[model samples]
Target: MLGQAVALLCLLAGDAGGLAFANAEPAWREKERLLENNKTLPCAASGTCSLGHTRQWTGDIYPLQGLRDCLRARVYRREIILVSENRLVAGFQLYDNMMQMGYDHIVLMSTEENCKRALRAWPQVSCIWSSQVFAATPKYMLDRHAFLPRAARLGVNVLCLDSDSMFLSDIYSHLKAPPLRDMALMALKDPAIGWLNSAVVYVQNARPDGPSVYVLNEVIDRLERWAEAREYMLGRNRKDFCWEQMAMSDILMSAVIGRPIAYGCWNWDRNVTYRDAWEGAHKRYFGYNETGGIGSWHFLKETKVPWPKSLAEHAPGFRRTEGVTHQQVIQIPNTQGVWPEEFGGPLYAPVRGNKSRAWMELIKSDGMPLWADPEDPAQAAANAANRELFTYLPEWIGIAYGQDGTSGYWNPALYRGANGTGTSPYALAHFYRLFGAPMNKLTVKMANNMWNWELSHLLHPRGGVFFASTEHAPIPDVLVYSPEVENREWVSHEEWDKATKALTRLAMEMGRTVVYPAPRCNLTWLGGERNNHLPLEIPMQFKHQCIPYSPSGKGFNDNRCMLGGYLMQGCMAARWYFAGGMFPPEYDHLVVHIRDKAAEHPVATVAAEQLARSWDSEELAKTLMAQHGGLGAGLFHPKIAEKLGAAAVPAVPAAAQKPRVLIIPSVLQLTDKVGPREQLYRDHEREDFNVMSCPWIQNKPFV
Candidate 1:
């Protein structure tokens, strides 16, 4: 019986071991399953919980689940992608608005240091150190391009926003379902330049298998290649490198299909004024309509101006101004403190008039004093002192008489004999006319002779004038003139240099001076018989002594400063006057004329046609005036032409009426050894030719 019992115990033990083994099968299977799940998680390979390559967010794969949960929880769901430097003062405001809009997932992308700093300030915000993935040094537009691909790679729907912008409403509600499906990227339209403003762009990356991310990468790559090519073409040192929006446009137009979010609905540029903002605030809504409810207000460079009082309550750091009369207040340095009422004007207002002051100072320092009455004892005494100070002033007569016996043709008498009339008195009389009262006959004659001597050297073929030192260099005073020449044969580098030297010497003898070349053909009426009527209003407003001639080129009759007549200072000054530099304003347009013989060949015919059309069209006249800030009218002044008995208004050609493009040729002379000016001309030529050759305008009306 004992032996049988022991055998039964052994059998029981064997059965127990088999049961244990069967139970262990599930545990082994569970271990394998866990390993598989871990492999699929983003951190499994890196052995960390973080997600993404460049956009390394915390909380591992679980955070992604949380994101899904957050999206499911929201009525109008979307993620916010904000790219900015850590030093951006408006970031907190942007973040507050995003939070108010119910965006739980806020991804901030910036340089590593910036990301760290931002995370310290706002611990709840997810930050991405872009420099970790993007090898290039971050630039304004380039940084945004670098981060956008990373956002797309995150496999989530996101709205990319500039740090300067703020959301006023649920932006997703404005987008319809069909348009959203068709759009890979949606951006607001820039009202001024008619391009897409990437400041507030919505990128759809909802599906795992979506082509948006891939397409975005492709677009970025293409843009980079294009930029490289452009750098090679224009040289890397070119300051006006293509911005990110330009690249975005090229990509969207060429590769990806996208839609422009309505200007009022999504992008409200600076054109939406403070008044509009206040009205919108009072209404408790934002747009671009009569109701004035803007979806997003891009303050742009106007950040220095204070927010309206009604809207200031919504922004945390913004404070309402006290005892201030101005429409806006400047933001003070301290976030909590208000900008003092005494300093509560526009930040630029104080500096806006600084340029005018500089101009006034320049005029005071360099401008010649007005001539006094010849009969006055004080005037006689002053003239005597000046003559003694500048012993060479009287020698100018000797110089004209060729008493020095120089070989070159600098004599006024020689020029008079050759050109048929005595040299123009306009240049010499210009200063006296501007600053001095009426002059005696002898004094006027002296002025006329001095002007004649200068003009002889300038227009004569054999003339040579050179600057002796920096003291004799040309002053910055401008005299604007048309690029047209009376004689094309006179257009040479030698003549150009001599003419410039003549003008420079005249300025030194007189005061600070500048010469401006008007890009288009027009006339101005200096006082005399022709000054009866003023065609444009700008000269009248400025109390100008000279007014623009009619676009018809009429007042040109008996005018020695006519298109092909003798070169005169009155004509040049008229150009300056028409270009908005009326006495007090600073003259910034300093240009030297270099004639291109090849280019000039076709210009004559086209110029005549354009001039005729310009004379007839009041619209063109207003356009020209507007172009120069309401300074002067069109390429051709009709009233002047009519007054001059040259009014032959031509019918607008069918081709000329279509949206015309003005081709502004370079004033620089290009040669084998290309300088900066020549290079600029070449670049402009390339751009202009490319634009002219566009297929869309092949048959369209154009100038």
Candidate 2:
């Protein structure tokens, strides 16, 4: 009975200890030993290593060569070690992500009892856990205990990580031991204390002095002190002492013998800001918010974190205007923010003289250069007109163009001469019509069909072959043109050839149009023969009406900058009158010129205008149909005219019978350029009136 009782008591004690091991600190000793080994030894082969005072060989074993391939190709370590109680799910997820990142060795440490239970539950994730480890140590106790039985493991390093950490991207490439300090420490920045989070730590055993054995010891000692301090403060006796935090504060304040820990912004986000300041031509502001928005703030009291300056607060002659600069930040309202009151509506300007002074030129007054004339009165007026007209256009038109990636050539001028007209026929034909003008039929030919070098040509000085920087650069005896256009130089034949080949290759790769030597072509009122060689030479008086269409050769790169320039210039001109409609590459200029001729020859012009209108009218019809029918109209299908109201009398031909018109709702009208929606409804009276809505402008009917 005594022997049996003794045996039963021993079994019971073992079971109780097993339960404790399974509960907590099962992997503690193993983790501790590995930490110590990594801090002391080096890698013998690649994956296998030793820990603490014992050398042990621990790695994943595979029987097949193919299976080993997975281990080697993935750059995985032989094995990994981990500690947990009931965190198997977390453990496996962490293991998989890390394994893909190249760490292979997996060592799971739990209480012996839990280990048995967990292994039975999850056989795929093979792990080893022994209850031999009872507490946390500076070194891995499991590794240490296993070292004596197995001698193959030695000089191996270990990397320890907490379960909460996540890898954003592959960090192995940037991973390296930081510069070693004698007594290095990481500090976290807190409300009361500025320091680092000690959750994740890097341990390098590259010290020639046989590793820092006292490093972990010191940390453990500090941890003990921290716990003791916490317990003492929370005691029921209410001893005369500061809080646990106060103890930490005391330790930090006593900079007597311990080395200070260095902490910085690396591997973490830091809240840092600056004050607005300026020097010379430079301004500096760095104010930002937690949500990534930038702004300025004035605090009654200083914040715990350093505040940064606003990006726009500093300037050379900065003035704080209340309405303009709100909260010390310049509000640039984009798609998300509330747009300022001045954002939308018809831009109105005082009307200038109706007609050009010189009959030969369209305008007598000098105008501002393109793109840099938002403030110029004439430019502003033109732009305002363009915006107003833009509203009436059906949204589908823009959508269609966007889908088709509207095609056109961009042009640049190469040579400028005294007689040189800065425009091209193709440009005149396309650009003018887009602005609601009649198109002119005039074909443009290239000087060299071999290349499309329009941008460089436009930058070239006086219609000459010489480079801007060279001595041979053309000098106009009477005048020097604008420096921006004059600064471009003519490239040599070799350079041109190389450029052409390169451009061709690029175009082929990107599948875009290949255009070269783009001349500003304005074909309006100019005949094909008249504008054929418009940019070939610059003698302003060289108007040989019968210039050949094929100047150099046939089947060459003919799309010149003239075509592009003409289109753009036409768009600019269109801005003056018409509000809606995109510049069409196929028939815009043709329609405009035909409309112009319609005045002289009403029959032909009317026919051309009808066709032009038809094209846009078709798009308008499709847009309305989609709005009503929830589908796009077929391009080839005949348009079904729906009359919402009576058509107005034709102002041009009294006998011409007007067609029925479909009226667009006033609400939809303001959707594109809305302003003060409530005010708009309040201003316009509700009445039974018909609105003439063709796909084109108010009077212009689409075909």
Q: Backbone clashes in each candidate structure, one number apiece?
A: 30, 81
List candidate 2 stretches off by more than 4 Å: 1-86, 109-114, 124-156, 177-194, 206-213, 222-703
- Every candidate's lDDT: 0.29, 0.23
lDDT of 2 by residue, 84-124 (tens): 32344334444443333323344443444544554444332
Off by over 4 Å in 1: 1-80, 132-140, 176-182, 205-211, 226-241, 256-703
> What TM-score does candidate 2 get on C-alpha atoms?
0.22
lDDT for each residue of candidate 1 in 1-703, tens digit (9 for 90 to 100): 1121112222322322122233434433443433444344322322321111122252211123433332333213334455453432234435444443334345555555655655454444455542222212235445555445444444455666655443333334322232233344555444335344566555664322233332344334433433334434244222212445654543333221111111221122346574455445423322234564332231211122222332223222223342111111111011111222222111111121332343223222322232232224444333232210000011111112112111111223222233333221100111112211121111122212211222222222232111100121222222222344321223333354334323222221112232322111122322233222211122221222221111111222211211111122221222211111111111111111112322321111123233332121233333332332221122123432443344322223233221111222212221123222122223433333432221111122212
Best by lDDT: 1
After superposition on all CA atoms, how large is the RMSD of candidate 2? 33.7
